[model samples]
Target: MSFSFLPTTNSTTTTTTSTVRMLPTRRSESHSPASRCKSAGHSSSSLSNGFIHSIPTSAASSTQRVNHRQGSLDQLIFKLLTGKPKCLAKVLGGSGVLNTSKNSVAIQTTPIVERDVVSSLQNCSEVRYGANSKPRITNITFSTVTSATGLPTVPAEPNKARSSSYWKTEASHSQSSNNNDTHGTSVDLLRKLSVSRKESGSHVDTVVTTIDGQRYDTKELDSDPDFQEVAEWAFPIFQISRKYPKTVLSRLTYNIFQQAELFRIFKVSPLKFFNFFHSLEKGYWEIPYHNRIHAADVLHGCYYLSVHPVRPQFGVAKSPDSLLPAPQTPAASIMSQMSTLELMALFTAAAMHDYDHPGRTNAFLVQVEDKKAILYNDRSVLENHHAAESWKLLCRTENHFIENLDPAEMKRFRYLVLEYILATDLKQHFEIIMTFNDRIPDMDLQVESDRLLVGKLLIKMADINSPTKPYGLHRQWTDRICEEFYEQGDDERKRGLTITPYMDRGDAQVAKLQDSFIAHVVSPLAQAMNESGLLPILPGLENSELWINMNHNHRKWKEEIESTYEPTTTCNGGSVNGVIEEESASTSDSPDPRRDSPSLDSELSQ
Candidate 1:
């Protein structure tokens, strides 16, 4: 990125200037508006800031001059930067003389008049601003430029806090060879809080130290170098989060964004993030399941699918990344398909997908005709509520993390968040699996629709991914979710409503439920993800490791549960093997899991 601000008449002058350039605007989601900026000449022109905006494709070099204010060369250049916000990072980087120290820019004012400046900006096709107009702007050394409330627009590389030894082949694509240990840059945003604990030098936690303390208190995540090193390859968050449970969701969410370099790319202030995620934590009901822990787990799963699909094969091989697929391979390609903005959207949606859940499933909400069900018209009620409430939190000034995005990017981000979160509705579960199975063979990364379709699947899979985790972790999730379901059943019994299947307190089998859920929902999604090449095949393994994990959990239920507990009716309501449903309720009022899911195939095709 380079900027050349001076014009043709003063070509002989030896005064040096930076080369200014703009990359093509990326509006893969919300089709960028037809125009990036209004006409160059405005009814009122003031000289205040830096460089001229890259004229939009529609605004050709039309030199129609309008009313303008006469000002010095500094004001004109300054005005171009201040006035033309659409120029974004490219134009700012090109201006070699950025006054980075204070609010003002330190531009060297030449005798170039405002008329010529405006003319040059309008007729930009031919005008050359400096000695080397198209030179790279390497000297533009500012890592982040941010407004008080806005996130950083200039994105830095992802966090490289961990050692590079265990990273797969994907690192080579974004990382430079010169930098040996180029882990994503670690900016511990937790230190920015004005809390007294840090000032007193007490060896304290990032925010709070207890379960009863403020959940919204923004905390430092993984300041310990030892933990970070292990985080690179040890176990997933399903285990780690349980060990350090204090503000775990908030910290885990921060780490995900930190690793992705969302803070640098979006220019989000660390302090502001504390408010956003803590609010999310506060919003999560402290239930048996669908709590903050579950949200954090899903976030971890989604990010891994997008960025690090191939886990390094530890100890088994001399080189940890040897089993890693090549960058061009289909399995590896899915890892790199998502853009940073899309990553931001995916992760944000993941973190808040189940926000404000009331320990009830969508089926229960609709069965009871709960207010939320009415609000969403009884379709995907809980999911709609989660997305809607998360947006409300973002709407608050403290949690305005993405305020810096342009209208088009902002709109695109909202669309992504809504679609990703909404996909969590169980009604869309089989529909998404159907789509994945239908499209997996020829999935095209170049197509925006295809990319988003995969993103939705990723979030949905993440929501239900506990079954594919380590057996102990998977069992813990099963216990928690069953407890929540039973609690809802208790409430249903009190209200005199016929309890849905799997909610029967007396006869409901936890082990049977786990086995049935795995066989019906979890197994199919895992198969689709594996066949799609999103989950890479492990070295010398026929199926993905996740597939094996699910199978192991399924087998454990049959071995330990059915033999131990009573199993009168099968899970599928069939007489033989168990299914997802626990009882065979013949009443019309009881919600049918099969009928609840309306077809999404017609909607997806559109």
Candidate 2:
């Protein structure tokens, strides 16, 4: 995937056979909108964060409107890709192929090789900033040219038939061959090539020459020792889903790739992100129930389940000879029969189980009596809403990421995506486990082969277990969740609504309640998940265990806060504990918390 940066003074649209030739804008001009596009590329992936899976063509086309408003974002991407600050600025200020005002558009007329030569020369401009105080524009416009319309795509190597391993070995051989001959030059060229490959959708075998007169082949570069880490992280996910349809995975990957591109478009201004935030809030944003990462995880898990010596009571891959239907054969396969679509759905569902979570607990939504609560009649409001919203977002005809899918298969996809995401809600945790117990009537059968019922449970298991990922990652999740909670709490306080105790930071006693809640609820759930072998690779197991071990750690932290400010301890124990205990006592024959002064934290400590 070699990338070339092109520069030209032309900015006119010309017509050609079966396509339009859109000429470049002033490549040497400063204050160009292209400059804006450069900076926008930085956070493209993070911008699309919170979704399960996004289909490429559909997601991109659907978000074209969103992209238009974020024109400056494209400039940033252009800058990043080309490394031309001045040329980037000129492109952004309505001077590039991005003249949306023109009724007509132009396509590339030059051959790909010539374009590469030009693009490379223009790329040299990226390294310099003149004495003039012109702000570099990073944003630029992108116009897609279909191959069928005669536009050239990234060129592929004609006779490169070597396997991936062969290429790696070749790169290694080359690296040691010349200590300084071309190794360092090759490294830099390879980085640009990789980025270009990403942009042009080219194969890894592609080659691009850098300005430093160094030639680098991506295939050879990929064979390096350092590159192995990336391959290791990617291969497991790819191998798991390798059996699935190429289009599904391809589109999924492309969508994620574009999302990273789009993130750069809007991340420059916090104000720009606000529009993005509002768009998301107003419903343009949907975290897909089956997103990319989740799809990868579920597919990976499916592989583990498929090949595991030990099996759960019920789940997918019931048996090798179960005569389960094929996934693509959607109409023929009954819901009971496992198929590729189901597998994809399962994987997709797992990936998008918690797409775009606003991060508050279900209890917070219920206590605040949010509209979501009313919509769901206060029953699993957050869970129900997430599932509903994710589906609604996917239903748009434009966002039909699941292309080439039959109507019947599409319907099934929707159901599976919904069912799986809804099942991920914490409210259904206990019931899901119980269902697992019931579905697997025989212990022997449970361990004999992987059951579809058990696999479903495992899918849900992975979704909830996400927070248990790793200490640093898990803490990051916690922070996001806290941010969401605080946002909700702020809204509640502004509305003069009765806010959930710990949700509202303004409450003097909130810290103590939070500490206690962490002890009893968060820590315990994390521990249970770690012990269950479901999330064997969760982030902070060791650190969390240490935190759990110290009975006085949370208390001491709370006491430190209490020393500065005091408030009436509404419930002698933490509020969450008191509420849970009271609710439990009233609903069952259990003893009341008033009679048992032992705090939930104390109980947990024991």
Candidate 3:
């Protein structure tokens, strides 16, 4: 199929016609104007491929106008095909037939089938029409019916002459498809670019690698054989302090990371865990009874209670002193109901509960007007400091262990930590015990709040479990606490300040204090927990050897007091010691002179 135009003797008159024939691949000799047309005003040019273009001319002025019209037709065709009308026109007008001043008129093309137009011009390949041709448009192929900027042109599908609306619809569809492809390609390119940039440095190559189905960049710590050894160690609390006492910090890190892996709750890089543990350990003050070792102990206690099923130990029979009416439910059944996240929160709170403690009681701090007391307005000063400082450390870049947690999970984690840590304050002890006492009968471990309350009580039990340890360990902790208290009392005396009770070095009796603590605090707490069936009789409880040792120590204190002085009634009607008076006056059947003594009751209270 081809088209041609022939001019008559008068330039204003022309005829256009079409012919259909099988296009041959053979080239033909270029035809001159006179050869193609004998009309005096007609001129023709034949392409090597046998296509003819004819024009009409009268004089020099009309010939220039004809050339200008030819150039305009060429520009319009190029623009319709390539979607850049002005760019092609600018290039051609500068140097093509339209460059002459007299050649300023534009030509209009006859109606053409849209499909044929697309098939004929889809090839954007460059072609040189003449030596003077500056911007060629031939021999180029575009895969889609659109230009470089993704704008649609003619449709590739063959169709008869279609309305402009039909072409517009097809063009819109083509534009949408092109846009989708371009957007997808752009995203893929960006991803590849990011990966390449990250991997470009040797540092990245050295630090990041896969391990046990996760990636870690922890300075090769994960590869260390010792890490595996320590991680797999059973009973980390017992082993950590005993085997590697001086390496408490390292042991804690290994244990925490190992637990995270064991429970499958840790999904972050090992580096983050390591950094958090390091910062946490470094934050603890080196106080005698509340140092890193104690923190590790508390953490170990929490971990033990969390994972171990409450089973009775061998060689230990049911204690006659157990507050439970019968053999209550096993501790394992209650512990089994706690979630992995709950266990993690409990362990973390234990490890950080006493962080940065100054080895002083809250009461002492308040009475002495210590800076911390002033900062916290004399309320839970140490507890508040621990929670705040520990949370701050976790927020640092390297120590963000929980950074991957979603917003809700993170908020829950923070809440658990704060609740458990603050519960350790002794001022809250009576209230917590009362709450537990009230909730024990119908306590359900399946409820999250109930389970959390249990966790809180467990942490408190662990905090004060020192006196329930085996006699040797019990003595060690007791001495440490006493020494800490006496130091406070000594400071008080040096400043001529009123000495805090149980803290005065000269008058404070260690055995008497232990006895009172066991009777008033430890015993009642254990009884409440046992009745609630929330905890089993662990090794260091009132039903274990700890209770027996406590009684023996108490008896020894009683014997010392009795032998020290002769019985006497003072003008105040009180005995020399409070404990002696309470035992004699409360238990004795015979009415003594001080039986109804108000001063005796007052002295006993103090």
Q: Judging by TM-score against the true structure, name the best candidate.
A: 1
* Candidate 3, residue 412: lDDT: 59
lDDT of 3 by residue, 109-181 (tens): 1112122222333342322133321221111121353232243332232212211121121111112222334
TM-score of each: 0.61, 0.38, 0.52
Write down the worst ten-residue block by lDDT for model 2.
50-59
| Per-residue lDDT of 24 in model 3 | 13
Native-to-model Cα distance after best TM-score fit, residue 206 in candidate 3, in Å: 13
Cα lDDT listed for each candidate: 0.54, 0.36, 0.48
Q: Which runs of model 2 end up more than 4 angstroms from their true locations? A: 1-339, 354-371, 406-408, 437-467, 507-606
Q: Count the backbone clashes (under 3 Å) in each candidate.
A: 31, 85, 6
Best-performing candidate as measured by lDDT: 1
Off by over 4 Å in 1: 1-222, 225-246, 309-333, 538-542, 565-569, 573-606
lDDT tens readout by residue for model 1, 363-392: 667677889989989777888899999899
* Candidate 3 weakest lDDT stretch, 10 residues: 24-33
User: Candidate 3 has which clashing residue pairs, if any?
Assistant: 124-140, 125-138, 125-139, 125-140, 126-138, 310-332
Query: In candidate 1, what residue range of length 10 has the lowest lDDT sum?
Result: 184-193
